[model samples]
Target chain A: MSEVKSKIKRVSALKQRGKVLRDTNPLLAVFQWGCNHMMNEAELVSDQPLILDRDFKAFSKVQVHNQYYNEQELPNKFKVKEYCPVVFKSLRHRFGEDPADYLTSICDGQIYGGKSTGKGGGDIYYTHDHRLVIKTLAKEEVASFHHTFKQYYSYIVECDGDTLLARYLGMYRITVHEKETYMVVMNSIRPVGIPTHRLYDLKGSKVDRKASDKERAKDLPCLKDIDFEEAQERLYLGGDTETFKETLKRDVQFLEKHNLMDYSLLVAIHDCNEQTPGEIDRDVDVYHVGPHAKDLKADPKRLYFIGIIDVLTVYSTRKRAAHAAKTAKHGARAEISTVKPDQYAKRLLEFVSSMLA
Target chain B: MSEVKSKIKRVSALKQRGKVLRDTNPLLAVFQWGCNHMMNEAELVSDQPLILDRDFKAFSKVQVHNQYYNEQELPNKFKVKEYCPVVFKSLRHRFGEDPADYLTSICDGQIYGGKSTGKGGGDIYYTHDHRLVIKTLAKEEVASFHHTFKQYYSYIVECDGDTLLARYLGMYRITVHEKETYMVVMNSIRPVGIPTHRLYDLKGSKVDRKASDKERAKDLPCLKDIDFEEAQERLYLGGDTETFKETLKRDVQFLEKHNLMDYSLLVAIHDCNEQTPGEIDRDVDVYHVGPHAKDLKADPKRLYFIGIIDVLTVYSTRKRAAHAAKTAKHGARAEISTVKPDQYAKRLLEFVSSMLA
Candidate 1:
């Protein structure tokens, strides 16, 4: 909790005093001084009015504070309900306990990220019931802190060991007497025990055009190490070239981000008399060669590590030329010593994974 | 003409070429880039494309020189027949000669102004054949500058050489292309003998609040020569009470660009009146005003010069305050000085009349 507290910057008391719009009408405040919240969407109008009443400051601040409290506290109420069948079944499969199934829905407590940054936090929502918004409160004392929805959810999922993709369950658009309109969203309960990797295949089908609709309906893309050549071939088959390329690029990134693959080396298990690349078993999950390599082409039991010995090969020459072009654009050193092939492989994999996922 | 040429910069030359795609495809060109020209009233794209060609060097100077010459020499086939009744009537009124009357339609060399620019220039289109579109000869010329239809009519009515208001005739949408998709608008002619001051009443009525069909028809609050008091009042009327004072305060600009009322000195006139305590019709327009002053009273002989004295008084005080503010902002004294009432009054009259004829 202290770590989480340190991560968030507390909203200053000066900002909370409602001093921001003393010279303008609160209703038209957004028009006068443009709203910083999603400011990109609206245009600023000239000749906006001013608010003059000093007495309204305390009342406005209290109203804002209460809204903050209401948002967090009310959202927790829906999580208490045990009626969700999907959540219940997932819990039973994982823990073999029907009575304690709903405990998974209970929040372990939210972790605040650095800021309410666009690239950072998770989006939290309340259930349809107004009671769910009370999750924001702590004994009616509003503690102001900033956090992004992405970071918030990432922290929660990691701590709770759940594989649920956050989904909006409901929303309430409420207007306060003196303040602006606010929308509070409620999210459905997430279940545990399912692997994180599997969730990507399940939810990713919506945007994944590489898989046919019929194939997607039957089975998701299996979470296994993909062959680099086959993936590149699929991309080049090219009915829709851009789409295919993007799909392959994202797939590579996904593998690297999750620490599943590298590019320069291949892990081979040859004791089963596999002669060609196609003979490799479906169960054989190909992993990238690690940085530490000694002997090559030894027995499987002897741990012969993956290695790229043909640096003078045509493929290696092409890779070096591509690297040089990129380096030149970035004003990097022209020397081959600056190139980090392993890191490049890792980044490439992550980029691919993000698109596929 | 040289002075006008000196003021204008030749930004770029555009080639008027269209692309033919499929049979159903609309003609495409560089000018229509980013625009929805397919829509009912669509014209040029919003983020206008670079109109000039990539290699901007003059391709052929002789070609452009010949192009302009050839266009002027070509006879207009759309000219009204010599014996036409409508042409005969217009020519009879214009020249009062039977031989001249035979040439029914004639080109009057004046650029029609008021309706578009809110300033009076020339009414050239009246005597010309209304159906004809006058074009430039160059194939590379852009359409907006290529042709103008003889749409508007203007007539001067006077008794004993004393000029009354130039009366405008009614407008007609002159279609130029197939399907009558495009139009050129002409001036709305008025009865010739109306007094010049009466043009304000006519212009005011043209702003139809009930004409829900036109976007510009919506009532736009025109701020003319509003003194500080009227300015204060209008500010309150426009917005809620909370923002009224603040918005007005921000708008109280000492060094007003006044370009906002480019057609008239009416805004300045209003401002002068409001600054003075008890004066009505501040006579600020009597001071140096420009062409956009149609909505103002400009009769110098009958005008009381008392308001001029008041304005001069206010101007001196405002000048002192303006100097102080500028010195404070820029940490230096500026060159703005207060004008004496008698001197300002004389200068104002000279500037105003210089614009009239």
Candidate 2:
């Protein structure tokens, strides 16, 4: 083992010497050799029309997507300071050889805003060779992102028998011309069709069915009597509204009984005058808000829920809690308090139950 | 004129609509059309080398000098945000066609960072076409940057009667790799050599015998004995060191008599440490600490200097005085005192005269 280590060290020493030779005159042969190595390995990610057709099978679900553009049609201009060139370098370094290719594979090249399904950064395009078209962004313009890693990773661990949002692929920042804004690129599961359980109003049902692992593990909240339009109205135009705490409380209890996951919900309100086709929850993704929750609330459409990871529960909790948080904030500051994650979850569950009752 | 105004309003309306259309579907032709217009009118710049061979003239004397990486070696990499695609769409919406190209002309493509310059954001590379090689950078294992902008800009403004630094450029975020460490890029400035005056030694005999407008206009100080090394050391590692304060006083007086410019200085100190090359004036721009005074220590090899900006003196004085007033447990803080630009200049001259006497 020692001899092998020595051999490895010897090889490393030779590599170091070569690097020194290259730096002695970067204009020399060694520098060119490194550049060529990088260039040869990189494959431009070509642009693809959004996988709108839902043919998930044909898509690698993780294969590279390339974008191409005539120089005239590129989205961003070279900005010296804020939009400086080093951003490109940082991205390349982070992704390695085919950084562009790798990003293109997972990213959806669209300019998202309003009530997005939470996946967007800027206006991206694919080249014929699969190279991606990257543009400059500020903090507020991109749509939130929703990511799914389960399909990609095989080995999974159960932490307290609840699945958690493990990592983020990337985030989105947007530069708005009319206004300066910032938002995240988010990823969330899109429901193929409405589930049977969703159709029944959850207002007065007391038939407690035996908990199954599938049902318990799922993050969906029990559908209760809801007035979505009313909720939407209150959300768009700031005003007081009914609390869904009771409904949320019941569902949270159900989730707890099943040892379900913990997650958060965020809703983004784009424009008060413009009504979007989808809900903010549908458009945005699981964002890691290390702080800045107050700024997130500035968007009327955006409402967030925490400590429930199931997609359905995350969605429901967002919609219900957003309406509640908005109304509560007239005295909102009095109700919601940031606590330890576990304690916060318990309080959230109680809040939801009180609303339903 | 009325007709033209009406036309302008109509055009603005169309432009706004066009932006929304492209933003919604960046994949659509509308976005491509917008990009074309932006790029066509956009300015093109190069990732030229940061250093020049004395006579190289790709840039104006007022423009910055950049040293490009030897093509034989890896070019500087720039990492952009992943959601750049979405941001690109927004850019198109706002800037119209060829927005990217327009921005390119203005961008300097340099990254800056103090603590974690090269880590977390990953490595980036550049191609001859100016296309970026984006990569991921880790938060850990980053490299610090060495480019000096605040110092350079300050030096230029102080020594040369130029107000060019007022035309502020933006900052860039990038990552660089040197050996094993990585760093996140932050800011870059136009790299031009410091003017001869800013590099003068207060006590040195080699003074510009032919004084210019600003110098000739003032009551100049004739210092016979100045410690050039002490001045340089203070300039490199900032503190309210006795030598540094004295240098600032002299330099301010020089500016007042010669240029008729008014400014003040604020010296922030926490016990000073050994000088670190480019780290002294990280956030101290010309307007903040006054312009920089060049390092005229006998050892010409060292490029260190005292980077001071004028704005900092005025603004910081007001802020500091206010803060001091607020915290006073005694009588109200004395009327916020500050060194008026002219007064500052005179004081500097006085200090120099005293030192010489």
Candidate 3:
């Protein structure tokens, strides 16, 4: 009788544990499921020496059924669409990310930070290790991504994944309960272990480009171009200046050619002097040492991690309308952010160049 | 401002809805995940003309990593092992189950009935549509299944899935949070649409064979051989009597040859007269018209659906000891259920034969 009682107790306890693990957010659950399964499946296919035109358009869609006992916490039915798996796999390879490690970082543990919303109304999340960022995308943004992904892939290939643009690892469209969520996974700009003392989103615009009071009240506010200029901030790259400028110019040219605008140069500054001893995880925070760190002019106080983000937005009719409105409001020569792609790229390069010491 | 507030409200509402769907039971979730994934994958492979010896031992294992945000309600890590995919696929094909329909049935909807516990301490679940039963298995039972699966597959092939034995659909071993749960999916013996008026688990034994008071108190208790004897029940097969007897003898002989014992003939009686109009779903309740329903001796009042279950148990040393203990307690000639396979099968046949009218 006692054994039976204990057995029943154990069973109920296990059941209770299962109840706790039930996925309350099935959209995220299915996204993870899709990534894990698709990545594993993608890994099984041997690497192709040359990228095919068809690869850019390749997508895998799966409809999942979670009926009856199986429908734990997830919707009884849902769908996941993975876009450009082969291209993303190639991008991940070019970016020097081990597929297994990337998978582990993205899908092996709990991801944090869905509370923070992006400017595009998409939720932003970070992997527990902070090596990657998963940003939800609006449907139009997903359309924009699909529109420019081929050129994006080509650029990444040409640059050998060394440019400042966000390193896209994967993209997926998850549909749960008839609602669709587009998400893109990319390498985080900030180093995983380092504490950023200051961050800025620089688009070379002076008109209404300051961070909001609400944003300024945060522990680490993402300031704007005006904030950077007011603070008299400058990056002391020493001998790496020319290489950085060349890469920046080339990336800007690529974006300009594609008629893309409204992108920001995301900069994160780590005050090395303020960091505690052994606070850095070198393995995870690979960006801590800049390219040509050894050639730096003995300014040991700070390190910077930077990347270009929000590059998916094109200078389409929607942006042209916004550009016209901003021009009228702030005057045609107000250095407004929503300029044409050519003017946007030129002003951004000049502003960024002035910040180099 | 109102628009922003409404958007926030909508987002919060979606999040709340997601919270409701969160899976608390990771074990069942993973089981469902594994089944849904593996079955879909199996369907993609073209059918093999012949089953090789290697196919019998073939299995697939997947290790899932659910780190950070991806971890949601699932454990950070878990593993799923699918055993004998090819053999099971073959078995399913032979059993006249459409692979696509089977997948949809198991994974597309909510599976019900994890509350009922089988005698082996395993939880029994029914598919939402009641076409299948999913039973959790002990590790030993998994081993026992593996031991006899080759013969089982061969027997299934020889009989062409026409035997009265329980139809085994799929088997899986799911490991979550370091705990392992083995599960088997099979066709439910009882008809789906028709309500069973009485159910019996007849093992042809007089000792300790009756349903307990607690079991009898249930809405539909699984009565035993003693209860059946007490009720003086009989099956009137009429023109189908000889054919039914032949099938029973053949099935018993097969079990005996394999050293299997302690199996039960599960009987469910559906009273047509007591059933509500339109209650019977002919499509789902395929068994309503038994194999020889037309020749069922002019019995318009009742329909019987019967099958052999618990056939995985083998007459090993453990069972031999139980047989000896029971024989000593009840005297050598007693019709004990725990006897050697040959004796057990003979006695079961004799008892079943006596019920034929």
Whole-model Cα lDDT of every candidate shown, in order: 0.22, 0.26, 0.71
Model 1 chain A, TM-score vs. native: 0.17
lDDT of 1 at B356: 32
For residue A217, give model 2's deviation from the true position in Å. 61
Cα TM-score per model: 0.16, 0.21, 0.53
lDDT of 1 at A133: 19
Candidate 2: residue A223 lDDT (0-100) = 28
For model 2, the stretches where C-alpha displacement exceeds 4 angstroms are A1-73, A76-357, B1-349
Q: After aligning candidate 3 to the native by TM-score, how far in Å is the CA of B170 from where it should be?
A: 1.5
lDDT of 1 by residue, A1-357 (tens): 000011111111111011112111222222111111111100111111322222111111100111111121121011011111222122223322321111112111121111121111222222112112111211111111111222322332343422211221111112233333322222222111111112111111111213344333533232212322224311112233344345334433333333322122222222323244454332332222211222222233222222221111121343467557757765574322224444544444344344321
DockQ order of candidates, top first: 3, 2, 1
* lDDT of candidate 1 over B131-242, digit per residue (tens): 2221111111112112111111111111211111121111111111221111222111221111111111111111121212332233332222212222332211222222
Model 3 docking grade: incorrect
lDDT of 3 by residue, B87-117 (tens): 8888887777766556656644555666453
Quick one: best DockQ, which candidate?
Answer: 3
lDDT of 2 by residue, B263-343 (tens): 322122222133345544533532232222233232223333333332212223444465465447333432212233464
